[model samples]
Target chain A: MASSIRDELLKVLIEHQPHFLSGEEISRRVGCSRAAIWKHIEELRHEGYEIEAKPRNGYRLVYRPDRVAPEELAPHLQTKRFGRHIRYEYSTPSTQTLAHQWAREGAPEGAVVIAEEQVQGKGRMGRTWHSPPQTGVWMSLILRPPISLAEASQLTLLASVGVQQGIKRVTGLPIQIKWPNDLLIHGKKVCGILTELRGEQDQIHYMIIGIGINVNTTSEHWPEELKKIATSLAIESGGHLHRATLIAAILKELEEVYQEYLNSGFRVIKSKWEQAAGMLGKTITARTPQGLITGVAERLNESGALLIRTDQGVIPVYSADIDWKEI
Target chain B: MASSIRDELLKVLIEHQPHFLSGEEISRRVGCSRAAIWKHIEELRHEGYEIEAKPRNGYRLVYRPDRVAPEELAPHLQTKRFGRHIRYEYSTPSTQTLAHQWAREGAPEGAVVIAEEQVQGKGRMGRTWHSPPQTGVWMSLILRPPISLAEASQLTLLASVGVQQGIKRVTGLPIQIKWPNDLLIHGKKVCGILTELRGEQDQIHYMIIGIGINVNTTSEHWPEELKKIATSLAIESGGHLHRATLIAAILKELEEVYQEYLNSGFRVIKSKWEQAAGMLGKTITARTPQGLITGVAERLNESGALLIRTDQGVIPVYSADIDWKEI
Candidate 1:
């Protein structure tokens, strides 16, 4: 509640920047006492804001810090459901684990777990995901869809499209979805998605979609082995990006797409995914448990199984690791 | 370990009943001192076993309590997977809850959690399952099958056939499977099965199959509300039945059928299920979520969905509650 008051005070200060506003005016606007307004200004100054106060002049704002605090981002959210109840952390093991724990305890749908950094971030199939502090958008979204288990892969595809469109809208950079769960820019990976579900037989209980995006990470921040394979927005665009703005944009797109999918069906999402897919019609090799199958990537079936046309037949690949050397 | 030793001592006394076996001879056979044997016998007597002790005659077993202990059940398990590790509880809230928790913690396949009674036993669709003390087989079996999520209902059918055959072999009574997950004897439900799974997209982590069998529960043991719809083996067979023997028989049958299904697919299991089905070829009314689907229950498809031939078309029912007036 105190933080909300500070936000109200900050909003007032930003509106009257470069000019002095009286303490009496601020107290009246924020419904607080003049002494309370002075205390709030002191707290705001401690939070890396430059506020000048004189005997005659009341207060004037100069600068603000670059942070993704909730009080800073809550006012920017445009979605109806997603990120309404956000669990923000500075550092944690994995947001996916926390999302699963929260969903088990009957957390409301669209609850999000976001972290500035992950100490032990997990990717698909027990792989490690690189998540450094304050340079990426690392978060997990909780959903309790009424769809069956077979449609889970399609939901993952839908989320990938949402992330791709979000980054393109914010940065004006061309983004491409690489088949199932990755987003690429100029042939380098920028985002990875992992979708998990908990259910009983034919019905689903809840789903946790963990998304990790490389936002402002530079080449120096990447590990030696990953420097050639991974690239961030700042590295490709030659400019640093604000993390909170991009996060809010992505959440808005995701929530809109999710609601649309629930209302109608997956047709709209399927079309958007196919339009952004980088693997369609490409000659690729999918490494499955059976063996390597080199074929031309066809369209995704209704159940989101990738249909690969090989020499034998059109094989529906439910899960595999795809490689496109020409791309 | 002490309880196991007492079981062994009880076994020794039962094997040497009506004959005078001195304490020295019993100690030599069990690899324990005379004082230890005496202590074990005293403990066994406290566990509702009447043992006669004399100066020269070591001990004679008069009676044994009707309880399903691990020692009594483990020797009869003839399977490679099912019931290899048993977690026996004298009383618990529900074995299904415990089984799901253990599965989440990476419990091994074929782990069984059994309770003599349940305070909060649950049925499908949020119904109550009455489980009185030491009169029913309340257990949950953990299975990590290689099949997909859609085949879960078929696995439940396979288990029902296994239980039906096992009861027939033990008591020579006619048992019929009620379509998907119930076993009935004399038109009354004697067993209820609930199948739940934990999975992601196209992969499964583990499944818990909770089975509640009315083994030795008499008519007087059931609540008034349940007496009309529930029956037990003891009440039907006109004699007291041993729960350990029935449980061991069911496990062996289940393990064999499950292995066969994995190797040769669901054909054999489906045929067996159809042979024992009570609703097949009968006009039944199914209370589905959509509405009441009244039709002739034709047969089970390969995925275990029941095909009901209605006037409109043959609709495949994944889950529903059925009502049949006569077989």
Candidate 2:
């Protein structure tokens, strides 16, 4: 009930942002006393909502926190279904695991799970993601597409395209994709996408695409190993960006790309992925479970395999960790 | 407590199946009073176990019920892992659902869920399987194999081979496999296999393989629609067969075949599948999601796709319902 009152208060404030709603009117609108309203407003301020209060005119929403809390995100999200139903966590082991839980519980398609901090953030192949509190956009989205098992990999590529376009729109940085689904700026990793799925022999049941973006995350806190390979939007742009705005931008872009995929297929977005990839004709080494193979990364084929030219042959690599040499 | 006592009493009786333990010895072995032992014995008889009580002998195992219950299956199962833990439901919505539940709770690989009746038995592409009570073997098993997504379908083929070999060994009835994973006898389906999986972009997390075999199910109990297309072991053999024995036979064959698959790969089992399939050179029609395609059945490819020689050309089918013309 207290949460509902807060939500109501937030709704009223956001609806009339930059304009004052008198305290009595706000109380009546939220069905709370003026004293209660003041308390919640102070609580909101403590949660990083900047509100301005004058003598006669009661209160106006000045700024929103860089939080991905549903209220902070609802205003910036323009997508129909992507961020409309968000399960936000202040702290969690992994948003990917939460997304899977929600998906199993019949969460709607395109529902989102966002975390301010991931104590045990996940990366591809069981690597720690290192997501700090309110410093990165750590999220997972649920998707259910009627595609074959073979096409599941294509969805990962599609998500990479979304992240590339999203980071471009928000930070004006040209993000390059590292073959399967990692986003980089100036050859330093900024975002990683891990696509997990529930499927049958011939069909995919559901997919959870976990996207972790280092937005406004400072480099001083990075582990020594990550400092060499990873970079953040704040570090690259030399400014702290609004995390809520960044997530909204991503969800908007992702929903559009995902709808495009469902309407036609992955072919329309294939070229977009390739152009952002920039891995073609680059000297690369891929670490596979079988062993390591150094080759010239040729192309990402229609089937989502990274085709590489090696002394052995032009091999289509399915699953691997890629290391590309800088130009 | 009562269930454990029943298990203990069954163990004592089975150890002396042809013989008999005196009431005092039986009560002492079970650590229960003679009255309590007699009550459990009566309950077992009510559940379809046939026990003889002579003047001096406490109990003689006259006959064992055709049940896939844990105790009934314990001695028959010859596998090292498969069916090591049996979850028996006298009636359930679907064993597939229960298996998923247990799996989510960290049930070990090779744990089995069996149901006497499936109120909502699942079939491929959202069809109803129409499983009836205490008649057929409707079961699902959990598997965790380090296999690629493309190779998941091959597991179904391996399972089909297990079912074929099992049926052949148990009833001496030569069973034929439809291209992918259906078992047929005299042109009627005797079993259906559905393989579901949970995976990420790089690796498969787990796969649930649901196999429903029509053993000892009479025609009178079958829904009208299934009468023409489906047949049971009892209907085909003109006599009821032991459901537990058949389940054990399938588990044994499945464990051996599954182990071979894990050790070597599906290539070793490919020829075995082909030998049992008998689908090549037959005029066939495949009803796919796109549309129906008529052709001569060519062969099951290495990737587990059913290659059909259509008028357009030889095409590979991943998911379809088959309609084959009789030779």
**What is the Å distance of residue A179 in model 1 from its true position?**
5.2
On DockQ, the leading prediction is: 2
True-structure lDDT of candidate 1: 0.82
Give one digit per residue, the lDDT tens place, for model 2 in A1-327.
124788889889998988999999999999989999999999999988999999899999999877789877765778988888889999999999999989989998889999999999989877889999999999999998777675677898999999889889988977789978888888899999999998776677789999999988887879999999999999999999998888899889999999999788778888888888868889999987667989999887656778989999997777888988783
Give a tens-digit lDDT track for model 1, residues A1-327.
235778888878877888988887888988888988889888988878899897787888887665666765665678888888778888999999999899989978888999989999988766899999989989999998765444556688888988888889899988888867789888899999988777654456788889999988988988899998899999889999988888889989998888889887788999999899888999999986557999999988766777899999998776678899655
CA displacement after TM-score superposition, residue B79 of candidate 2 (Å): 2.0
Off by over 4 Å in 1: A1-3, A9-29, A49-66, A147-158, A172-174, A178-180, A265-275, A289-304, A307-316, B1-4, B7-30, B50-62, B145-180, B261-277, B280-326
Candidate lDDT scores, in order, read 0.82, 0.86
DockQ of 1: 0.32
lDDT for model 2, on a 0 to 1 scale? Answer: 0.86
| Candidate 1 docking band | acceptable
